[model samples]
Target: MIRQRVIVHGRVQAVGFRFSARVEAQRLGVSGWIRNRNDGAVEAEIEGEAASVDAMLAWLDEGPPGAEVTSLSTADLAPTGERGFRVLS
Candidate 1:
């Protein structure tokens, strides 16, 4: 398994981005957590199969229909072996 840290910017918070992420992550069988950053960005770290991680990242680019994802940044991370997607406060 692999891991990826994703930071999404622009009109992310209060747009159900984290909830959407939980849905997508569960659908893809990925495990990790997502939260809204103090700077109005949504950040998440996902760990799972390469294809699943890729799918989540791609979806994050657009996010839920209400989200206006202007930019996205991702970094490779060591696998955390996380299980079950979640929303962090």
Candidate 2:
């Protein structure tokens, strides 16, 4: 399995980005959590098969139509061994 931490920037807050991320991650069979950052970005960690993870990253680009993702920075990481995807408080 591949694990990754992603920081998505640009028009991410107050636009259902986290909610959409959870739905998309579940749909893609990814496991992790997504949350809003103080810096006005969306942060998430996704773990799954490489293909699924890659697919999820691609979805992060457009992000629920309302999100205008200007950039996404991804880094390889060890899996947190999380159970499922969720929207973090």
Candidate 3:
């Protein structure tokens, strides 16, 4: 399994980014949580098989149609054996 913490920057807030991420994560059979940051960025931690995690990251790169993702940063993290995805407020 693999885990990653991602911070996405851009016009990411109030554009359904968190909900879209949850749907994508569930579809990919990955687990994690995504939330909006006060700094107008989106933050998330995803864990699952390497391929699934990679897929989730790719989806996050584009986000929903309204999002204009300018940049994103990621860091490796230990897997937590999580089972479902959530959108945190």
Which candidate leads in lDDT? 3
Over the stretch 1-89, how does candidate 1's per-residue lDDT look in tens digits? 99999999999988788998899999999999999999999999999999999999999999998899999999999997878999999
For model 2 the TM-score comes to 0.96
lDDT of 3 at 52: 94
**Residue 75, candidate 1: alpha-carbon lDDT:** 94
Relative to the true structure, candidate 3 reaches a TM of 0.97
Estimate the TM-score of every prediction.
0.97, 0.96, 0.97
In candidate 3, what are the lDDT values of residues 3-81, reduced to their tens digit? 9999999999989899989989999999989999999999999999999999999999999999999998999999989
Clashes by residue pair, model 1: none
- Which structure is stronger by TM-score: 1 or 2? 1
How many clashing residue pairs are found in candidate 3? 0
Off by over 4 Å in 2: none
**lDDT scores in order:** 0.93, 0.93, 0.94
